[model samples]
Target: MKAFFSALSTLTVLPVPRRFHQCDEKSLAASVVYFPVVGLFVGVLLVGLLYFLKAIFPPLVLAAVLLFVLVMLTGALHLDGVADLADGLGAGGAPERMLAVMKESQVGAFGVIALVLVLLLKFSLFFEIIDKGRWLDFVLMTLLSRWAMALAAFLGKYPRVAGTGLAFIGKISLA
Candidate 1:
């Protein structure tokens, strides 16, 4: 239970007791298992927000608000990853140089472009899904994307000797 709570706390902006955020081998392991579960919770919240606001706001306004809520709720964790990955890929040098670029706190041209394209894709996709009346598709896709994050963690190697991702680098399993 503590592990699940830890995962929820780490993944969402939902108020979690500070004590539950403690990092330990046990909680780290449990958090991976709960990663998708966190996404499911997020997706449900998004779906609810969409329906509630759909009747009150124009589609464009609602889409903007929905995007804001998601980015805020998740604290842009995945967005940060996208930016880092973009920097690493776009650095166009030795692997170490790319890694260093990713580690840098500043966003590069590639990072900005990547983030913009991703957000634009999301915005247009949301518009189409709403037009087609496919709310369930949105929720399911959200769940699937988060699950992919867990998969990536399981398969990924740590770029640096130590960092936030080290916790999951060699310490994950499908089970």
Candidate 2:
């Protein structure tokens, strides 16, 4: 469907038809329902990659590769959000000032630190999961994270008058 294709194109670097990339606002908002489906697809790809590479590389190297592939797959969209949020929170002043800081193109110290910490945490978790041979956890992790993103969008208010999240933020419903 258009909604699923829209969600897939928006969430991942994986190629979808160009027409799918240019969706109406309704289709964009409806795409929220398919976020978890996209996540499941991504998870399956990662699991398949892990199985293929498990013997070719050690756990540590494989973990890094998996993380790299995951980042590449999503085009580091969440990581950018994390860094921007860190920069905003780290500024620590009025809401307007924090928003200004976040809107700046350049990353600050807090952004770097946050990115490092997040990547490290993910790397460690991936290492542990691979070392323990818990491959299925990848599916659960990706699925739940995407579901959480949808839930947040459903419940969250869009602070700015207009921004990237306007299409879905506070616009999604359970129905």
| Top TM-score hit | 2
Query: At residue 55, what lDDT does model 2 achieve?
Result: 83
TM-score of each: 0.92, 0.97
* Clash pairs for candidate 2: none
Q: Candidate 2 lDDT, tens digit per residue, 4-99?
A: 989998899878987665567787899998999999999999999999998899999999999999999999998998999999999999999999
lDDT of 1 by residue, 1-175 (tens): 6777777877888998867666776567668778788888888888899889888988777777778888899899889889988988998789999888898999999999999999998888887777677888767877888788778778887768888878866688766
- Candidate with the greatest lDDT versus the true structure: 2
Candidate 2 residue runs with Cα over 4 Å from true position = none
